[model samples]
Structure formats: C-alpha cells, structure tokens
Target: MRVHQLVVNFNATAQKLVNWKMIRFGFVLVVMFTLVCTVKSYTFQIPVEHDKNGEAYVTFDGTKHWLKDNKNLEYMDAQNCTVHLELFALPTEESNAYVSGWRLCPQEFDKIP
Candidate 1:
C-alpha cells in the first residue's frame, strides 16, 4: 500500500510539472503575440541609390544623403514640419539599403500626405 501511494504521489507531481510547463509556454506565447501586435507598421517611399564612393544614398524629397549599406529605413515621426528618419538593417542576404525613417523638410510641409 505504501508503494502504491508513493507511485500515485509521483504521478501527481509529474502531472503538476507538466501543467506548469504548459502554462509557462502559454504565457510566453501570449506575451509574444502582444508584442507583435503592438508594433506599428510603416511604409516608406524614398529611393535608394549608390553614390560615387560606393556608399548607399537615399533621396528624401529630392535631397540625397549617403547611408550605410544593408540598412532599412524606420519611420519615426514628423513634428513642426521636420520629418524624422530612422534606419533599419536589411533582413535578407542581399546588397540593398533602405530608409528606416524620414523627416520632411519644413518647406514642404504642405505637400505631405
């Protein structure tokens, strides 16, 4: 009878451990989903080209600026006619650079969409 009781207790403990692991996994999944959902998505329309020195260049409202190769543009925000620009790294195995963000010039504030 003691052996049977011991076996039952061990089984209960194992079941509890399994349940705890599953709950932890579920919590992780929920956290990940919340993070993914809360991230804002943005789209950029800047043109990227290479400069004479082989560095990447992006054109913002016709003004060209050199950028690091293999980066992506991240959009920050526009305030008082200044458009902010951010850069994100390339996610693929290619030789392309992208604008991570953009800041509109104060002069062109009326033309922004």
Candidate 2:
C-alpha cells in the first residue's frame, strides 16, 4: 500500500513539473532540424569566382579548372556528378548584374540549365 501511494505521488509531481510551452518549443526545433537536414542532403551550394573574357571558375577540394571559351559559364552539380552550364551571358543590365560577382547558388536550381 505504501509503494502504491508513492508511485501515485511521483506521477502527480512529474505531471506538474512538465511545461506545455517547453514541449511545443521542442517540437518546433525537431521540425526545423529535419527540414535543414533534408535540404542539405539534396542540394549543394559552393562559392565561385568570375573572370574576364567570359569565364567562371571554382576550385573545390583539390581540383582546379581554368574553364574558358565554350565551357566558360558552367556549374558542376556535385550532388549528382553532373555539369550544367551556360555558354553566354545575357546582353542586359539586370542579367549582367547578377553574374558579375562571386556568388553561391543551389546546384539543383542550376541543374536544369
């Protein structure tokens, strides 16, 4: 009878100690962690440099590619081991402005073209 009463008292105290707000916050953190992991697994973004005479360059790991001429504007999707590239830049202010500096873009978005 004493053990049974102690068990009931412990359960009551445990229930009172739990805060609903803390549980809700923990749930949100789990969701956000999952979302970040899923996206990172499927997409890769690497910083790249641009050069004159129409060229873009990236030296990831220990590889160096002096990509020029026909392979000037190119992106190698490290996720799928595929290369998607653009041969020429558009002849407009907005389009030219975007590709003028070093940048990072998800390889999947550039994978289509």
Among the numbered candidates, top TM-score falls to 1
Every model's Cα RMSD, please?
Answer: 8.5, 11.8
Give me candidate 1's TM-score against the actual structure: 0.52
Q: What is the lDDT, from 0 to 100, of the residue 59 in candidate 2?
A: 51
Clashes of 2: 0
Candidate 2 Cα RMSD (Å): 11.8
* lDDT for 102 (candidate 2): 23
Model 2 ranges off by over 4 Å = 1-18, 47-113
Off by over 4 Å in 1: 40-47, 51-55, 60-63, 68-77, 80-95, 99-113
Count of steric clashes across candidates, in order:
14, 0
State the local distance difference test value for candidate 2.
0.52
Question: Model 2, 1-113: lDDT tens per residue?
Answer: 99999999999888866766679889999999988875556444344455665555445446544434434444544454443333333343232232221223455466754
